[model samples]
Target: MNCKEALPLIHEYLDGDLHGSEAKELKEHLIACPACRTLFKQLEQTEAMVRSLPPVRVPDTLTAQIMSGLPPMKKSRTWTDWIRKHPAVSVAVVFAAVMFGSYMSMWNDDKNLMVKGNDLQEVIIQGDTVIVPQGHTVNGDLVVQRGKLEVEGDVTGNVTVIDGSVNLASTAHISGQVTKVDEAIGWIWYKLGEIVNMIGS
Candidate 1:
């Protein structure tokens, strides 16, 4: 198969969704295609890094709020009446869902907090390095005054940074260029020290 046809199948191959013969065909194609091999490796690494982070437990209160807002109903009521009776209830439920979703969307690491695709207004890369993982498409520009950056996803807008280095991942597709400045020196120093300690250990 040609590269274009084989490209979409790569995901299936990695997911083990292919039949034996199909799998063999794709494997053979990958061996001959350098670009596809590199892409496969990058995707594998991204998945591994994302999985390594501990799962964030949704707060009990938040979960309770969500469940409570959802409020189970009796089977007797009609759909229209249920919606009419719970007009406020429905709105509350939707709001709660948004809150829960937003909380879960953000990724917090020791060095920097990477926010996944969300309705984030602006991002300021202060002290530590912030990484936008692959497959996370941001709606707006990433504003970093100072800190390291790794963008693996597509940003719909421009990237502005003051004094930090942007290390774009091979799979990254940025729609805008990066801008830098030199305001947050203390944070940078602290971040550098932490990075050094981590490397040494």
Candidate 2:
């Protein structure tokens, strides 16, 4: 099969929906086409990276915050009646509360170092610091969270340091993009993008 046909199958395979002979056909196409193989690998990395992060949950305080921000209810106006009458306002309040809760969690959490990747035998760990020694090579994407990453060898794929810092030695070689994420709000955008990709796929 051609790339045009294999593209959807790749997404379907990642989604765990591809099966039978269709899966075989897609595999054969990926093996034959370098571009498709690269795309599949990228999609795999994206999926793995997103899945490695802990699930974001709205904090319990969100309910109290939303309720406290609302105007005092009158004896004649019930909560259900108020919600029915102002559906849009209610939705907005809930959405705002959720966003605020997520932001709060993002700011308060992630104080410890976290690393996610595959085939990281070359990566060194010491307290909150991660190091890739000289002459070593990492085969896939490397992600470090709330820590420091020092690279002295080679990384074949992307390197993303979130809420952390990275130091690359003169001998360090990275084949893919390197990203340093310092902002707290970046998590929200990443989650949104992941959701969009999942829905579109």
Candidate 3:
């Protein structure tokens, strides 16, 4: 094995997780390569020293304080048990009530808001205005086609702007490059194409 391959396998060898054949190959390589042998010895010594350190003890007073601060444990009941005990009609009624309560909780949120699904990691702002909140993360592409983007969050992928402005907060992080287009038509077309591609996927 070369240095690159053997380097990665070193950890596996130390942990005794490598297959017998792979271990033997690594060992043979180590025997032939003095540099690798020296590195392996250093790594082994470091591991040994770390393992020899004693575990820390938690103070009795601190442990007692933590236990006192915790709430009392409640009896656990399975959802299956609860459902089985109720009649079909009663179960349906309960389910509807729960769903209604869940929707009602979000009723106060602005109706104009559009929060993308989990899979839609990429987002393109195509309107005249857009707002991205703090701590929100976009895992894929962020294309500002024709609108304003106020970002206080992170974008994991590329950010592109076309014929519009983007206002970035200090907290914003874009992992990929930012590109801009000059014309409105090109921006709209690109955004539409991206949306179509997302839907097809």
Candidate 4:
């Protein structure tokens, strides 16, 4: 199998959905072709990264409240309903809410510390260090601004560290992207966009 034929089947191979003969052929091609092998490894890494993000679990009551806060969606609604009707907007709202709630839960203490509980679903911030303790599980994304993120637990969502670093312990299991934005201007833009999205929503 050539690169052209092998590239498209990479996902199926990774998913274990390819037939035995097809899988064998792809494996052979990957072994013989350096470029294809690199692409295959990259794809594998991407899949692993996605599978490692923490899962976000919103409470039923919170869901009800958000739904109640939104204007009613009518079958005939158009332009004015764009914000509420847009799937991406809705997802962004939920993500922001979850992150906000997580950040709120960590209020009152400002010291650099680590997560202590199991089955958590909030964002935490420490002065310069944010640690997700061993055995702890976070169902929401984690954002650390001007600090570092140390993950030793299972996270089902994304981890974003602005102008800081990320350290994943041996036991760390993340199911989403781990992003680090080091540029000051980029961080400002990101924060601004976040604020705008929340306000728009």
Candidate 5:
């Protein structure tokens, strides 16, 4: 198996999810390719390090604090109910929100943008730098333009870098593709395609 074919399967192989024949083929390729083998080893070590980290402890009054900060819930009919009933529409709404949030964040003046917390459903973008802090979980894509992306958290979507670099810290956990393009023209095309996808969804 080629590097391209084996790369995506590495995670599955590590999880013991790959079939026997596929695993054997990947193992053979890893033995023959130094680059792939090194990448596999790094990923394995990162996973081990993450597993060794201590768990975070939440405050006992966190629930009460959250409840106190929020407005009282109402029984009135709302768009939220409709959205819950239509999962497809809900997904589309989330996509639109992510796209919009990402686009807006790109315009901010901050050089270092950070995304932290759990159950986040927004795409993140930064013109200078984007940091996904450790222990955070993001449910959407991340885009970095003319800068860098530092991911030390969990990402449920893709990571795209344009004319920049990506650093996946030891604690980072990504469930989707990671893409980096150095060309300005290619980045423009990619942005256009992403916008089209957001609108189409």
Candidate 6:
């Protein structure tokens, strides 16, 4: 057994969820590995300290004070119970609502420049231009909306520029395709493509 596997089992053991062979294997790993043994001791001490603390009970007056503005009501089930029973459906509905809100705000004839990407740590933002500086590395896909993209360094994924210009320097290194979208329809398609990719992933 390795420390990687034993680490999780240590938590399981602390939670009293581990048993039999899995627990035995973790014990052996802990005994063989000095680092794992030290970590296990620390976690064990933390757990013991936590268990030693007394349970907390919230005051009823505090709850009433927080709920003072709300009208008194009887316990009701309907939508709340339905949501509880169908959590997946509720989650999908909420996600769709939030996405719709974001879409409306983003594409409602606004001229504000926006940039979206999973990795923008290496990107430098100027007034109207986004620059990937030389010698810096952008680790993932980059999207520049209503602005300019000046690429001089390494980009590990796709680069998309919308309603803007992209200037690639001689030393720029891009591992994926680069696309420029100009028209409103093209922007819509780009957004749809992003949504599809997000869902697929």
Q: What lDDT score belongs to each candidate, Candidate 1 first?
A: 0.54, 0.66, 0.52, 0.59, 0.58, 0.65
Q: For residues 3-29, what per-residue lDDT tens digits would candidate 5 score against the true structure? A: 888876776775557987898899999
Q: Write the per-residue lDDT of candidate 2 for residues 1-201, one digit (tens) a residue.
A: 998888778768877989999999999999899988876775565455334333322233543464576664443443334443444454354345345531111211224566665544466766677888899898777888888999999999888888899999999999998988788788667567649967998
TM-score of each: 0.32, 0.43, 0.31, 0.38, 0.39, 0.45
Instruction: Tell me the tens digit of each residue's lDDT in model 4 across 49-89.
Output: 32442322333344445457566444333321332234334
- On the 0 to 100 scale, the lDDT of residue 159 in model 3 is 68
TM-score of candidate 2 against the unseen true structure: 0.43
Instruction: Judging by TM-score against the true structure, name the best candidate.
Output: 6
Model 1 lDDT tens row, 24-130: 88888889998767666644443343344343333344445544746765544432344334544433433453566522133233433443333332232333666
Model 1 misplaced stretches (Cα beyond 4 Å): 55-106, 109-185, 188-201
Model 3 residue pairs with clashes: none
Best-to-worst order by lDDT is 2, 6, 4, 5, 1, 3
Q: Output the better candidate (2/6) by TM-score.
A: 6
Largest lDDT belongs to which candidate? 2
In angstroms, the error of model 4 at 156 is 1.2
- Residues 72-157 of candidate 3: C-alpha lDDT, one tens digit per residue: 22223222222222223222333453455311100001122222222122233333455555677766656554456677777777
Count of steric clashes across candidates, in order: 5, 0, 0, 15, 0, 0
